[model samples]
Target: MKCIMDDLTVYTPSPPAGQNALVVFPQARECPELPPSGYAPLRGSAPLGRVMLRDGRSAWAVTGHALARELLSDPRLSRDRSHPGFLAPEEWSAEVGTHGASPALVADPGDEAPHRPPLPYLTPRRTAALRPHLQRIADRLLTGMERQGPPADLVSAFALPMSALAIGTLLGVPYEDHDFFEGCSGRLLRGRTVREAATARAELERYTGQLLDRKRHEPGDGLLDDLMRQDGQGSLDRARLVTLPGTLLARGHETTADLVALAAFTLLRHPEHLAVLRAGKTPMTAVAEELLRCLATPNGILRVAVEDVEIAGRTIRSGECVVFVTALINRDATVFAEPETLDWDRPAGHHLAFGSGVHECLGRNLVRAQLEIALGSLFTRFPGLRLAVPAEEIRSKPANPTSDGLLELPVAW
Candidate 1:
């Protein structure tokens, strides 16, 4: 296929002679150590280019920093999955794309269904109010890790459990229910088949719906209760309330868990960064932002063009799908000097790691708090922390190209 670049025509490779050729979406199967491919080649091309989805669907891949932010913020680009030609993740079936909201391992505001009430408690003030409680949660999790000693899988021992506990408490879900929710959420978010994901989603909604009913009569001291209070005050409907918690439970734990594990892995690989944290030379929060930029793992988010729109000198016809390759945009050389290098001391500006514009990550403050406390308390307790296995040997969940997670980050002190 031909792409117009600055009024010059460029041809993307087509199939060989007789057989149909597929423009395969870039996979990191070979470069497991780095971000996905396809992106590097597009660096010299137009801001928006083409890539074929696994389902044999063609979509635009937005890779430039400026264009990515522009398209993300543009209201003409709809995140509503119901739109015709909406692209679901490669793992999902076409039937899944035709359904309601797509399964998201990482939630963004744009994905919120129209019926759902706004998550007011995710505001900065509310996150700040929950700080002391989160501190206790982080400290307690780290304490358990310290007691267990090293040669432990951080994903299971520290990352997943800590994220589950913190988000579970905030949502008023019983801590005991976390194990079950975690299992279901994994299937919903990471399952390879649509049937598997749908089954997990149905089970999760049923559970959360039951909990929502109980909270209606017996209010608790968490966000769920707050939502229930809003429903009672005629601000939110019960049906929307029922569906909202499922989104929270599905997204809240998984992404943060991955962040914690990935951050730890990155630090272990760069002992000099770990040394800075031990020396307390820089604020953990600043260090956290730098690490977030380096470890930010969102692959790309699907958006459908609602109306004909021109972006980066290319016109996108209405109803066509476009994916903003966030991982590649976050590493744009124009924004981050030496974009590939991890520089804890580098003065970085607002990054798309949490996304941009109105659809920015609602849990940004909460995630920052979790990372700050989790990384600080963790390294403080284990000054001798080091990876138990070589970096190359560490495996990742290959089901998703965006995943920055290790299947198990084994560490020893």
Candidate 2:
């Protein structure tokens, strides 16, 4: 099966001749706890190798930890798909080209936002400060689940709502409008076609523009208020001001939602490790770090080279694609001793679960706090919480470069 992405055609590309690529999503579902073994042959042969994309175009896959970091920081490679060579697929043209979002996508480091408005608001200190507030949100959601009883779909019951509420609260988006925004967000992920995505994008853009206007008159403590304050200083122009919330409000929450659900599932899969976590044998903070490293998104990041360059003993022509295997890099045996085993005792903070360089995840701090708190709250609230079905019965989203989250995680106490 092709990669499960927005309602578009999912393509699984095989390598041309000698090239190798992580070409399918079915492998990802075969084992939810690990990245596809297809990545193994590519990594085993070399740290960097040529790969094939859906278009039968070749890309460079960086599987090593150190090299992924070096290239991640290099400005020579760009996220701007308009570059002659970037060749961002047609589906992405609307998002990167039409949106012109300064902060980029959630997975995007958003390093390019020149004096981006949300930076001050997203710092680790500030996001960490939201912990108490976020905890209340998480507690409230978990309580709702308990009242409803078990056999609940954790993705809907706990993960999605928790993430949506937290991000909505952070950005000051009205909670009442979450249903509308959530529908728009899913469509944006992958529309039935480019047209559907474009429609979703347009609706979201309109909503954000209107929301900005509303916030201007009714100021609040959320990030949007601060962005308005920046706009007053002429720091943010009409385009950025109008789109910032839509950009943040959409990707910000969904990105964390996938991670939350994945981490919870990962723990339940490992009963012994879950026991250690429950007993506090290892720090929850450290456990969160390990989960990020071990189960980091496998799709990695894509960068287009503006100029021809050589790295890891290979030459990449300008416009060629560069893939960083975040999942594999975090599992590098050289950097991570026994990378396959999820060991919280080790120092795992340095892992590249989130892309690195200028585009490193802006939501990093908030996500960390959420993951730690969400997990802690989950087990504490329902000590007996466990999978409601056989492991194989669970469904994994078709693998996509952006996410491999479960369609729904059924849980019971």
Candidate 3:
């Protein structure tokens, strides 16, 4: 697809900051190192640089706070992949793989016929049906944690297993199959190599298909079973159904697990906040809101533009990809006061943690519930929990392309 840039509007920066100030550019590669300071205004006066995507296409990446928000919510800027001139960055396409079978589903939003198939794992109706099972699984997780004792790696122990059980039970995946699914899901998320990600996805489809078939003959009260009953709701067909579990496996569990561990880690780092939560001074709802903001893993959200649009004085043309920097948005000085500081008592309000608009995360409510229960119970049960390793030594994928997470977070009571 050829993108016309002759008419694209150019942004001119005012001038340089102090000698030590970093230059901001439109090229994602040229993105300035984000400081630990929560609110770093965009170097607006700096010239917008061109990002040459791995695929050889170029697009403008605006770092200005106003520009980011305007571009994100603009109607002309779309998330759909079906636009006529739609293209994906080589790195992203290589990672997500080409959507051959479900071409329409992955097509640019500008495509004449966009497919919006209902996913069994994330639908509200399915979630409702799976609640009882989820509660039971939650109980099992808590019990297992109690029995195993602390001074453990929360990532592996409570977070991973609980996530595995919740997602597995919802999809009717057998406990014995956890490792296979988990491994596939992990590879799918982490594999930077095209071949590896594709292979993992293929395996995931095969596994989900097998599980769906099993649920057919012996239908249970699981989400998958409920989805099978919704024939006319553009419910996932066989091929899509098979791929659906993998999406759920990745989306349902990984981020939530990270959030759980990260939330606990954040609280431990901020004892006053932890005390506020435990003392019942702050409602669970308040804690949930704060946790959503504080515990978000750093990958941010990704979306592509379907049409040309002007935002905050910059023109974002159609067929370009925009990476909405949610982490930066949440900490914008204009939005949050003393953005650098973690204030549990800060007045709870709107946040983009679950995202905004039509594509907002479907499992957001469940995620919040799980976090509330997990954090509230854990901290209340083990008030003295603290890091077992040096804070700096704690291993994390700080610049992870897909997520913000710690490989191992050792904690002791």
lDDT, candidate 3, 99-167, per-residue tens? 211212222232122334354356665656656666566566666666887778878777766665677
**Cα lDDT listed for each candidate:** 0.69, 0.72, 0.57
Candidate 1: residue pairs that collide: none
TM for every model, in the order presented, reads 0.83, 0.85, 0.73
Provide the lowest-lDDT 10-residue window in model 1.
1-10
lDDT, candidate 2, 1-413, per-residue tens: 23221211222346446654444211344466667655555665457876555555667878799888898898888887556666444332222323212122433322345624355678877787788889988898898899999899998888877876677677777767867766676666445555665577678779878888888788877777777887788876767755665556445655677789989998898889999999988888899999989878545677899888888778878878887777778878899897778788999999997788777877888888999999999998889999999887887665544555777899999
| TM-score, predicted candidate 3 vs. hidden true structure | 0.73
Candidate that beats the other on TM-score, 1 or 3, i.e. the better one? 1
TM-score of 1: 0.83
Q: Can you write out model 1's per-residue Cα lDDT over 1-413, one digit (the tens) per residue? A: 11112221232445546634434453432233245443455555547788677666777888778888888899998878666577655343333222222345333332456643377888778777777877877787777777887788898888877776677667787766867766776666556666777788778779888888777677787788887877777977666665665566555566788788888887887788788888889988788888777666665667889999976678999998887766667677788888777777787556677778777778788888889888888887788888898777776544343345667799898
| Residue 350 CA displacement from its true place in model 3, Å | 1.6
Best by lDDT: 2
lDDT of 1: 0.69
The superposed Cα distance between candidate 3 and the true structure at residue 201, in angstroms, equals: 3.7
